[model samples]
Target: MTRELARRDGLFGPIRVLERKHDGARLYCINGSLQTLMLADGVSAFGYVHAAKILVAEAPNVLIIGGAGGSLATMLATRGHSVTVIDIDPAAEQIARDFFNLPPQVRWVTADPLHFITAQEGVFDAVIVDACDSSGIVSPFDKPGVIADLLMKACPRGSLVVNIVAEDGAPPWGGWLAAKLASLGLSVCLFRSEEGWEGNEILHVRVDGPTDRLAITDLEQRPPEARTYLMSLRPHVASHVPVPATSDNGAS
Candidate 1:
């Protein structure tokens, strides 16, 4: 049983209904703007980046680069984390508020992430990036460097978290991205999320280090819980590889 999801007036995007298993809740995918994936438990998953927050024992200032259904934002807020979410599409933010019950505690900012951060200097403990298509494919945004730069500027030395997607033969950005962070003085660790098959990844970069780099070999020695969590999402993830450190050029 499928139903037509509500469409907002003047909202610029394609709309479709997506049904999930178990309770059979329905979600609305707003195409390029955002997607509302219904969690089996009557809640909705905003399909944005929030997995990196898992590493933090306590939530800090959390920034979300994309606003889908506001799932991750809400989760962070619920856990008492000061969260701010940004999205270029106003319609997507509106829809998330209307349908997914995005909370008032989660500040919603409508602006380009790069532009917003360029004019100011701030820092955060965590940053999530979970925006994608309904088919579970990652959508191409602007330069990946923009995000890398934002991570460098907004996060205190050694405290940036980037959520990425893991795929089979996916050209191992784990090393490349981590290396970029390392060059910027952030020690990096890549972990697979417990949410399996969602292409979910959590890359944690510490801003200040002892200059003793965290080799990919050390990542394999993580506790069983972390390894089990990562493998759950990326069954094909082999032994870790050294991600590329950032170059001094600051290209991102």
Candidate 2:
């Protein structure tokens, strides 16, 4: 059973916090989308978070474009990476700390992600763009040219991960964004779950690197509880590629 812990109006719409009695997992919802899931111990309960963690395992510094409950920031910080999360909603920081257990060690910045990306001087080893709202991915990011420019500025020579959720059979924007980034000389891979249609599609883009597929050896070393979520990720070179019989496409 689940119980509501808190509810309030946020920058986008209604924000809610819920707790599952059986497992003590907290759910952070924004505009009705499951923005984040955190376990009782503050560990991330979302597969996409694990998939992103595996992809950026070697990075020492990370920048997250959307804070939400700061699950990705928390996971990365716990692993010794310097994590900075940016959100336009000032209330997100407090809500995450109060209900989602976002720790103080994770740096929180309140500003428009686009402005932060364009103005920040610090470079990150990995950049994850999970920015969204009630409708879908926020503006500027929805436009290929703008996101490309911002990403190039944020992590010019590092790994990049973008999370896009599909709702009501809506077209997956990650596919087009992948093509745009690939055309600009980045090695891009799109990951999706084969068992279901309604979920997140993560795009992994390498701004400067060999065209080798991502390695999942590190994921095998993660805690057993995360194995199922990590293994669900399947990579596609492009949106049009057919799913291979084997899930050998490496980490998401």
For candidate 2, write residues 146-209 as lDDT tens digits. Answer: 6567657888788878877755554556666676667676778888766433367778877667
What TM-score would you give candidate 1 relative to the actual structure?
Answer: 0.67
* TM-score for each of the candidates: 0.67, 0.86
lDDT for model 2: 0.75
The lDDT per prediction is: 0.54, 0.75
lDDT of 1 by residue, 106-217 (tens): 8888877667767656677666665443322243321246546666677655355555544554545544555555455455555554553345555565555432222232
> lDDT of model 2 at residue 177?
67
Instruction: Output the number of the lDDT-best candidate.
Output: 2
lDDT of 1 at 203: 59
After superposition, candidate 1 runs with Cα above 4 Å error: 7-13, 17-36, 40-50, 132-148, 168-171, 193-195, 209-250
* Model 1 alpha-carbon miss at residue 135, Å: 12
Angstrom error at residue 92, model 2: 0.5
